[model samples]
Target: MPLNNIPADRSYTDEHEWIMISPGQTSVPTSPVRVGITSVAAAALGELVFLDLPEVGSEIEAGRTCGEVESTKTVSDLYPPVSGEVTSLNQAAIDDPSLVTQDPYGSGWLFEVQPTQLGTLLTAQEYAEKNGA
Candidate 1:
């Protein structure tokens, strides 16, 4: 289920990832933006133990497995909500995977990308409903 606190400020993917738009940017973005797993995903994963992040300069597609997140309960693939070239990987999250469970939306961001596929993303409301929040 989606959390009400999942900010209405940006779009979310059905795969449970959230896309945070960079400041000063609006719709149909082509510049780098923050990306992270949602709280609902963090909770389901259960006690994150490791996170494999895509390298900068890597090309990723929306809905395609880009990396992985390992939790005490399971290991799960991480998907980008929109397709783009990865511009940066969060060294902080890689260094301390537990940060993902502690703060999935903020300091736990997975990557930055200059998105090329924003058209497929869902609004916050749509994500919430689709997830049965």
Candidate 2:
């Protein structure tokens, strides 16, 4: 899918990050959100070789470095689109870096999060527009 075609139901950030906001408010002030690398980011990285994800329960801040991926060309850092504690990582991607190259938006997702700040993200459409996608 084109990055500019952001789902209206979701939000995005300037850094080309997308957030899938969960329905309903919980103990946390806002809905929990899932984060993943943008299609643009994955494409630029080329074929991935290694992914270094944080352990679950680790606190992450918006715009802060959280992880890294080593591609055929170079290593790139993973940035958190929102502040939160990591809830999960894609085990498949950890096992096979190629998954990130093939399906970045799906099974290649790097992490799920319980966002501490929901306002830090942008919708898919917004990010796409800014990136000229």
Judging by lDDT against the true structure, name the best candidate. 1
Checking candidate 2 for backbone clashes, the offending pairs are 11-122, 11-123, 12-121, 12-122, 12-123, 13-122
Could you give candidate 2's per-residue lDDT for residues 27-133 as a string of tens digits?
34354566667777778889999999878999988888888889999998877867788888888889998887787667777778887765465656656777777
Q: Estimate candidate 2's RMSD in Å.
A: 3.3
- The 10-residue segment of model 1 with minimum total lDDT is 21-30
For model 1, how does the per-residue alpha-carbon lDDT over 1-133 read when each residue is reduced to its tens digit? 2348677776788889988863223465756988999878998898988888888999999899999999999999988877889999889889998888889888988999898876357777777788776
- Find the candidate with the highest TM-score and give its number: 1
Give the root-mean-square deviation of each candidate in angstroms: 3.1, 3.3
**Whole-model lDDT, model 2:** 0.72
